[model samples]
Target: MFTSGTRQLLAKSNKLCLKSGSYLKTFSAKFTTCDLYALVEPTEPKVVTENSPGPNSLKIQAEISNFQDIRPMIFSTGIPFSSSFISSLPFCENSFSQISSIPLGYNHHAILDVCSSPEMVLSLANRPSLTLLPPTNWADKLQNIHMKVAPKGLTNVFNTVDGSSANDLAFKAAFIAYKEMRGLPDELSEQELSTSMDNASPGSPDLSILSFRNGFHGRTMSTLSATRTKPIHKVGIPAFKWPAVDFPQLRYPLEKFEKENAAEEKRCLDQVEHIIKTSKTPIAGLIVEPIPSEGGDLHASNQFFQKLRKITKDNGVVMIVDEVQTGVGATGKFWAHEYWELDTPPEIVTFSKKMQAAGFYHQAQLRPKIPMRQFNTWMGDPSRTLIAGAIISEIESQSLVEKTKATGDYLMSHLKPISIRYNKLVQNVRGKGTLVAFDCPTPEYRDMFVSLMRSEGVLIYACGNRSVRFRPALIFSKSHVNVFLPRFESVLNKMYKQLWS
Candidate 1:
């Protein structure tokens, strides 16, 4: 049934092509193109050695750790093992292994095809400073891809280098808009501009971006001031005296505790309004994650977000939804906030990770009257945008968003019972699509669970104090979930027995 030509391509590509049963079957009936590309079956995890960071991986980590923190280092392996590991994992296939930033999968054929294109090569080789000299195709690229997918009610885009830059830019836009709303002129007087250099009020302006307790924006000066997850990140740095509001800590199995959760949300919303109304330094904006990811995979209801939106709008506070870790089809929707069904979209929605390009989408009003005020030498990279364009195209072509929604439901259904069975170690099993998480009884137990999982050849991570979060790629399939569930169940059973014993 093998066509000599098809066989040649497969051999040359070193990719597998499965034929349907029976050499006697007609060639066309037995060997379709879909059979060649579709995930045929889940592969078993191959742990060649007892230890996760096998001898070769340990050596590589040691060499790299000398020059870098490597404190968060996971063992490194050869491309073959890396690729194999990905194929067997839930979030990304090992073929194109990377940090969780991978959108589709490792060595995704679509991405590789884009990479091999001449235009992509040219963009890569001749990287443009997008703000100063945007490529001729920049407008088309934005209109066709990024703009096409903009959150409802947002019509403008301010491209940046990454998630932190997106947040920083959004904060700047909010600050400017806040000032303008308060009757500040577009052009600051020479005297006011001069006084700004001295960091005095009326020029530098006494305003802040209110953030929730334990929320993370980024590590840049302004962003760092708003981040409050850990002291280790802020130990020696001088942070702004910005107001911090309490993010609701709701009891989980969210349905069972609805009344309590509502009260908690109301309490948090009240605090947000109070901060805006009474802060010594006026609150120009409020930034929050749809679901607090790095902070702890914390989630609030749609009602909570809707209320926050209303409060911010009424108080003239710019509402910024940081979807850096939650955007681009992972949460069953392109943007997680889409689930909120906001009366009007948040004033700004910042994105990065899965989209590959970082930027904030906003209403046209957020655009500054002056041009150079909100810019940099390289506002964004065209090569990255091209890649992002290709990614968005693939998502549309393959219907990966709907696929992710279905696959995520399968995975969560599998996790729910595990949470019930191992009630002590696993609690609050909840998520939007594959953006799921549960809590361990304690930090030590959480760390141990993660370690055991890695030892078993599954890479995972913990967030907040005692929560484990899953951030798989959009292309992750139900078969991948099947591969991970048993391994996860085994680990949970082992942990439960050990804790009980």
Candidate 2:
């Protein structure tokens, strides 16, 4: 039941700017928030009516449906969203990770200040197609930001629109490098040129990317071929016959299943070897997520990842760590794969999400002999990168990575007991930093629990099938967690009565 007042506020919320002030001292003030960087105008959620996505949202859903598939409308929407939380009626702290974006949280003054800048507005007005004609400030911006935060070994960057495009371009780079390794001729033959037009053999080589089972790369043709999460995302679309191997499904409280998990990982590794040797189309690249998120926040031991690095190195296959979800301080470390401690770095690392900019990082060797083999009109957006630079500055100045790790330890310690008390409801409580997740007894239970948590004023999300994931922004603090945990317990208490009282 949105009032005319609430509706007007929601419509213009994006333009609501606030002057920066000292951090509010609330909830014990465990860790402090900077005056310039903290979230503002925080409010608690209010569920004014029964049923999530009440009449106002439903009416909006119908209106949007007249234009296109209204799937986004079907969601129990959090209408007025902010950096830390969203409010339909009940304002709840965000934990969806914004699908793992929103690095600083909704409207941090630093970012808003950047967004309101004359320079940022100019770029937004006349965006450049980066690959063809880069802005003069492009090199400076990359120097100050992207390169400043380049993954350990990778030197080059290719900015794109989103995680999917970042990965798609990364795959293209992999195939090009694969072709180079095979010593393919640069000049096209008459037959090769003609065959390409027909989408046949020599023209478009039968190169494939070897991915892991339950891994999700993207939804585009090449990536969707690698994606193996849900059948629905792939049911109607035709996919390439790319080969996939199993991602190790390790049992939790990892120490308990050490031997069995090692054996499981070894079995998976052996399959990778066999698949590479026997696949009909030669595998040009092997792409894997450090944590197979969306496939249910599945995790493997660091040793398992190291072994994977070894296997890809032994084979000619290019190793691509799809850091789209796990990068930028979410996983405690700056990069989740940093935990792997492999002898050699992966050839490519694709990133987006919290970084605000989307692209892959790779060594000089992966650069193609020629350009245009992988490009688009808007190679990337400069305005987004400007936001990214501010995020990087905040990350560095605030040391948010270290803060995230400490906060995660505190959270998991508290959550462990809840997992024990509510064993049937919350099991396998696992995480690295705040990229935490747990499983419900069933998908229906997970959905119900999420709605209940919202009523208690803590916004969370579900992934894989029965798992609920916590992806709070880097700015998430001890205060936020303290606020969150009690609400979580209250929901658990209410749920216990409803389900088992």
Candidate 3:
């Protein structure tokens, strides 16, 4: 139970603290205990110069560009404070800030505390190949980290290295489960084993995981097959002939377009069924994001997901909810799929990012019969798991999930008018928590708008070519929004004025 007065005081204190270099030292002195919600307040965005990367970033970039492809390189910041310059405007000062991927902000106290613990240090120094010889406390760490926030009815976890690998592993589980149901024996026969060497049937059977156009899973071989966000990520890389169905493209101002959006969802549902029934390859599973993140922060109603779950159950196809970008309290709920309230849990729910660990949660039945079938040398690092445990503890102790919901509502309420006022430049402002986004008129315009926002000292990210997605930390408070909104409005006004001028 966080009081508004406390929140305001903390925000004000943090603002003041950030302005001074002694904030960290003061914070360390004041709060010796590591409590989760102990620091849910706004911190000042450090701008040493007019630009983010300042002079230090350019030198680092110039040095790195000589050998490697530095196209994705943003400016770099030193330790304690991570920074990235907006690459498009190299000379622009105040252009570098943390991007949306930052969960608790750079060098979060809780995270650093966990890293400094003896248990964490040991795990990092003596990294084990978890698949073969996991640490003694691995099971306990899993219970504390992933299992603590496990979605309803999911008790088992298959840990992997990252989001893409998590989804890829889920796909493999689905394929194995489907084959087992088809009377395939646990042990491969001599013929099957020999044929598998040549990538033939019985081993490499004609199976596929159905995904949605514009949905992004990952860039790995199997996950890439399921990703359809952009051709640039797939070009020159071999991809599977996996089927992609249309995700519902709902009309904006949801209240005004409710009837049309319902019809659109129904149409997409029919298309999904059609693909499952008619594909040349058997559909072993269907992977969908609770919100199609990379596909432009696209959303479907709870009813839409419930109906999809029923459809998958009826067809004996595994239902996988890829929560890589939406999970771990970003979307109000710990798991975004919780919003759906389906009769049963998704067969697999994949997560990464904020969790600081990647894996799929499923029922006991989904576990492969043989151990080595679904394994890797370092399935997931224990130090990361330890950090994840700390994160979960902090989230619960501080009740950040509910806090995020409240703050997100606050943001959206303020953002709606901005969207309406600039309807031509900005449209379709929608999201479940702080995980919100809106579309700009064009890709170039969206990029420009993002750049301007960076220049104004607010960090944001782009998704689906024309949308600006907000992925702020759960600890973000209303005061943070107050600081952000004025800057955002100024940027919007500048854009509008520039366009007309």
Candidate 4:
């Protein structure tokens, strides 16, 4: 099934793998390697076509574009056929795992086992409306799967569709809780009942969720209103006139700029407090991402987050930590907010991505006393919940969280030196665990950097403005890192020569 050129590439790759055979054997046993990895034991990425988005990829994209937008798609991914011509098809050696959603990497045995189970099959075939007709073992699944890693101080779970809907539910719960906190009657007044239908005040009310600028919660109507990253996600859509506060832009080599970074954080916190106290629309909820994943992978000190928790608590606002992108061991801790070491946890913790299932954990007080307040046809997918169970089990059994922390330290140790060497091209190296990123000289440079990484078969992604973020799966080991770094430096070297040499 291989052409002469492909055979030659494979032959060269085989020669390169001899020295790393011991490491490859051990690593492959720990996790299910992808098809591409199975073909080549080392970290080499192969592109058989003359240029990427090969004819097959382009043809598939053209067919897909007939019915949907293909602008965001990078390439078509599928199992290569046994045909001789299939050698031209490309495969990603190490993906960020579908935007960092894949926890254990592709075709993980645990996940596959769960998916192939009778429970998963039954759930998929006979889906449940969990709020109304939940499965008999639903509570067991929740306790085992979701609650197993529930953030500290949160006792209740509200399963929803995804990060957006999770935040949406959290918003509604906050609004309801806000009214309750005000000692309003449980029953809606006749005026409120009538006004809600027309989408006006008193029922729909002049309430809002305050979000930090550049923090992304989700793309649903209410969550999108709070999303302040890119204009494209918000333009042409009507949004709530909600309040936003500045997120601190801390400088790198943190110790070098402690005073300035602290001052910047204080300024942002002061703004947050001011908006909370003085906004015309009562802020019922305040949503934030621990790492601000899509917002350039921005981070604040633990003290900054601890202060945020205290501020929201003092102001009686429901603090929702959007862990959609940073949760499930990506950031060393299962929940990134755990790094904050808060005396009291945030009121609502929203999560998705790696968890397979999506939802928010909250204090019981945040639960609407009335039923159907957060209802949906499929409250949450049971099959996905099953997958989440498998993921949680694997994370615990493998000690992936602790390992990820070590791996992150390893990555940073290499990255910091690289950043200094290529200071002109790479800047602001910051991350928690495997969730790492660095800024390029410009947005154009960042885009080119991503494209270059793709050409090398290391599929990465860009975030913020000029930032290149790495959201590798939890299973990303030191072996993978060893493979990734040489290529990473190669890309940097190429970019450096282009711009600076």
Q: Please, what are the lDDT tens digits per residue for candidate 2 over residues 360-410? A: 999888888776877899987999989989898989899999999988998
Q: Candidate 1: misplaced stretches above 4 Å? A: 1-42, 77-99
Tens digit of per-residue lDDT, candidate 4, span 396-440: 999999999999999999999999998987899999999999998
The lDDT values for all models are 0.80, 0.81, 0.79, 0.83
Q: Which residue pairs of candidate 2 clash?
A: 45-90, 45-91, 46-89, 46-90, 83-105, 83-106, 97-100
Tell me the deviation in Å of residue 101 in model 1. Answer: 1.4
The residue-by-residue lDDT of candidate 3 on 435-463, one tens digit each, is 88899989999999987777765657788
Candidate maximizing lDDT? 4
lDDT comparing candidate 2 with the true structure: 0.81
Report lDDT (Cα) of residue 310, candidate 2: 85
User: Could you tell me which 10 consecutive residues in candidate 2 have the lowest summed lDDT?
Assistant: 19-28
How far does residue 161 in candidate 4 sit from its true spot (Å)? 1.4
TM-score, model 4 to reference:
0.90
Instruction: Write candidate 1's Cα lDDT for 1-501 as tens digits.
Output: 346676555433433221222211332244443343333223556566688667877887888888997755566544543233224442323212253477976545566557667898898898887878888888998899789889999999989998899999999999889866566666777777888999986788889999998798988988999888988988899888999998998898788899999999899999998888999999999999988877888889898999899989888889999988889998899899999999888889999888888999999988888778798888878777777888898899999989989988998898888888788888888899788888998999999998888766677788899998887788777887887888888898888788887
What's the lDDT for residue 62 in model 1? Answer: 83
Model 1 lDDT vs. the true structure? 0.80
What's each prediction's TM-score?
A: 0.90, 0.89, 0.88, 0.90
Candidate 2 lDDT for residue 171 = 88
Backbone clashes in model 1, listed as residue pairs: 83-94, 86-93, 86-94, 87-94, 96-106, 96-107
